[model samples]
Target: MSKNYHFIAIGGAVMHNLALALLSKGYQVSGSDDEIYEPSRSRLKAAGILPEEKGWFPDKIHQGLDGIILGMHARIDNPELIRAKALNIPIFSFPAFIYEQSKEKKRVVISGSHGKTTITSMVLHVLKSCGLDFDYLVGAQIEGFDLMVRLSDAPIIIIEGDEYLTSPLDRRPKFFHYHHHILLMSGIAWDHFNVFPTFENYVDQFSQLAAMTPEKGAFIFYEDDPNVKKIAAEVPNTVRKTPYREHPAVIKAGQTYLLTKKGELPISVFGQHNLQNLQGAWEICQNLGITADQFYESIASFKGAAKRQQILAKSDDSILFRDFAHAPSKLKATVEAVKVQYPDRKLIAVQELHTYSSLNKDFVHNYAHTFDAADVAIIYLNPKAVSLKKLELMDESTLRSGFKRNDLILFTETKKLKSYLENQIYQNCNLLLMSSGNYDDMDLTTLQKTINKQHS
Candidate 1:
């Protein structure tokens, strides 16, 4: 059955991918976004579904459409939405629509504040490595996979479940919509302060996700996280409960090797968080009928997802890494990982406070002591970004008080930050740039080239 689907705000990373996926399935796909950005715009253009013009038209929302998939960027009072409501046209949030499509297939959802993308990518990598045919919806771009979302006749679907709100209209957390046949939670940490006001409120969302899992389903979680442990305890006995911790590994000479019963298995990824993610992925694979040996073999080749502790540049004396670590828990883990991996090298950690939660005055205190592992800590925030987000301006004193680090260097200008970094003595220092956004659009590759030129 060829269905006519319309997407509102299809410029989003996940939304655009889903639109392409539906088009690939022989469905007629049409979409409109107020403004489309790179990659998404280009991808949509290539697929021939790119809207001729920008803004939405109520005429697009008609009775002939099978369903309208809404993106988070669309507003409640959007003209298209108003028309759809008037016509009583069925509308679905991306997450809700994903559930609708995969209801018949076995859904394996990886959910948590951190490591969901890594774990989901790990599972996809392993499944593909084992020659298994499956559909998947991961957050980040994986190395081997061209598309982030895939839909097919595959009996199993792997999803990277986010706890963030599904859409502007759908206030429920995205993960709550995924009734998992197999659920894996890496850990829980308070984030999205705008949506979830308090730590307790944020934690409750994960608990609700656990409660929604069917009795016949399996709930796998990282036992190391106290919050996860609590969630595990609350699950019904009818649900199979499995717990995992960081995989045992030996770090020798700045290289990490997993110590499996099969002996030392060299993997492309490192850090305790990644090890824990790997363990969670291993458990998920085991439940999916993949043997331990097979899991180990496939995981060894896993290079990790993009921007999750990705190596930007490396030299004998100094190495540079860029990671998407906006949250406090993620910041602590990422910095600790780099310091632990290269114990001999001094670590200079630079993080950008770009996200809404990170920029919020009330939420800033959660980041206290997160940069203790770094020899030198620097934080950057663009005042323009704060103004655009309509957030109160955060001065250096407020940031200093928040992190409680007297020696912390703060920057409001990208040029100053870049100049400071370039002038730094990088003899034996590892530079780690952590941010969900690029540091005010600074060209990291250009900076890396300059740094290499200086040292060479």
Candidate 2:
């Protein structure tokens, strides 16, 4: 019999994909969401799996339903979730369901503070390109891949292993559930302040994830990252440990080309960190018995994960990019990557203090000297964000003092920030805007185009 499943907070990026995958597999699926956005709304509507407009319907939960899959957005008291709980029916978080589905398949989990999506997407792209059928759960909307979640009769499944709690109820790390045959740790740095309060605590989460890999499995890591190295060395087991570093590459005509041991490979994805990600992906595929030639062929067309060093617009002289780099380490790495990628171009690095941790006057010091590569560094934090996230409102003095960049400009209003950016000459310059949230719904794409027009 076909399984009947209901999703709490079905409007989420990963949740919607899971619903679609189940629907494709002929499961009776229903879902609820307070709001819906692009791709999810259209995709759900097309698949005939969308919730009827807006809200949690407790009546939707029933005893006959096989299981309820919950998203992180759904509160513990979510009406639909509460209804499912009362029924004592099987409930599965999305990650839990993935583990349930891929129990027998060889699981390849990509875990780290940053580059999880990129590394996972790379593995998925190569696997698909080589016609090696495999299921996957990646965070971003990857091109060539239609959805974020895929399930099939394939013998393998690769997942972007987020170190955050599995669910509000689970309290376990999301990556802990999967039966990992192959594990890759890109790097570990302090992140998700709400989850792990201290730097050491945040580092320990990766260590725990590493230990979860079976003794027969393989643990792939980026040895360049000291934190990743520290955790990799401690996981004392026969889990065949493989280390990867940045591949040889040269920047030419504003394009980056990688020089593999076999030959020079040109791929659209750039930066030393991304190069490291490619190496990790290649090694994971290699451990899975994929040939070196196959990995390179698939990576040729790979652009990148959405918002991870994604180019917004470009002109001969000016280029603008955006990234989901809110955490201190990610922000620093992203800035450094861009500066290195285009050394001749002046970099104007801008970041929005969107996360609760980043806005915290106490935690703000973590971002110190992160944007030192940029010719001009600007920190944009919305006052409304401070109130919404329930964080202490920081003064310009406090915010500036925390980042410790003396010449940094700070702004609370989009108009003032826009004005400041508009006046800047972008000649031979690159504008990098990093945030995990919209800058108060400011259209950065339009702004990038406007800036490009001025310079053109």
Candidate 3:
């Protein structure tokens, strides 16, 4: 029998994708989001599950419903939730629901402060290339994958585990819900300042995730990160613990080649972080019965997850790249990667302080020296964002002090930032835009066109 599922706050990226996945599986899926945004709205509309009306209706919730999947966007006092609770309908947090569905399958969870999406994407790419059928839940969309979440009868499922809170009502972190048979930890860095006040509290989440692995499960982690190394050492002896560092590779004429016994294999992705991510993925794939040669052949074609070192435009003399790097660790790795990729070219790096952690005056100091790799480093923040986030106004001196780079440039106006970018000489230069959010809604396509036109 096809189960009927209703989602509250269905407009979230993962929630909408999960709804579509269930719909594809012949389940009756209904969803309601007070306000839906582009991409999610359009995709849900295409799936024929877009609610005809916005906001919750208590009438939509009843005892007949098989389940209610709660998204993080919905508050604990949501009307739909209240109705469902009153009716005694089973309500599951997003992660809990996913766990319920994949409990029968072998779960491979990639968890860390950074590189979770990239590592998960890598594993998915290799599995798909090797003709393996598997279900997956990745945080970011990847090339050739139409959806970010998938559920099927496949014996295995790969999950990109996030450390954020599961839902408004469920205080547990999302990764805690996943009972992993194969767990991979890339690294641990303190993030989500609003939820985790101190660095130690944030690090404890990974230790908890490590403990959730079954006795016979495998724990793969990056040994380079001291925190991850410490966690791996403390795991129960019953679980198989494997550690990896950056894959041995050489860069020749701006191309990265993996060093293997077979020979140097060229790959589409670069950077030490990505190499480490690849190593983590390789270990997971190996545990899944994929041969080393087959893994290499498949991984060489992996282009990387969207927004993680994605190229926006390129020309003979100049190029433009964009990354979803808002956290301090991600910011440092991305800047270093682009610089390493084009050593001879000038790197013009622009980052937006949009996340709660990045915008917080108290947390800004963590970003010090992260942009040292960029020849011209620029940080952009809109005052309106600070007001919206309910954070204190951070002055230019505070930002300058936080970065500790005398040459750092700061901008509060999108127009001024755009103007400065437009006026820059692109000859033999690489432009890198880093942000979890858009630069105050700047049209990147238009900016790319303007750069192309100027170069033409």
lDDT of 1 at 351: 94
Over 1-456, each residue of candidate 1 has an lDDT whose tens digit, in order, gives: 799999999999999999999999999999899999888999999989999999999988889999899999999989998998899889999999999998899999999999999999999999999999899999988999988999999999999999999888879899888789999989988899998988899999999999988978999999989999999999999999999999999998888999989799888888999999999999999999999989988988898899988988777778889999999999999999999999999999999999899999988999999999999999999998898889997887888899988888899999999888877777788899999988877867665875465456
Candidate 1 lDDT score relative to the true structure:
0.91
Clashes of 2: 0
lDDT string, candidate 2, 39-157, tens digits: 79999999988787698888999998999999888888888888887899888988999999998898889988878888898888888888888889999998887888999898989
lDDT of 3 by residue, 1-456 (tens): 989999999999999999999999999999898999878999999989999999988889978799999999999899999999999999999899989999999999999999999999999999999999999999988999999999999999999999999998888899988888999999988899999999999999999889888898999999989999999989999999998999999998788999999999999899999999999999999999999999999998999899988878877767799899999999999999988978999999999999899999999999999999999999999899889999997877888899888778889899999888987888888899999888877866766875566546
lDDT of 3: 0.91
RMSD in Å for all candidates: 1.4, 1.8, 1.3
Show the colliding residue pairs in model 2: none
Which regions of candidate 1 fall more than 4 Å away from where they truly are? 451-456
TM-score of each: 0.97, 0.95, 0.97
Backbone clash pairs for candidate 3 read none
lDDT of each: 0.91, 0.85, 0.91
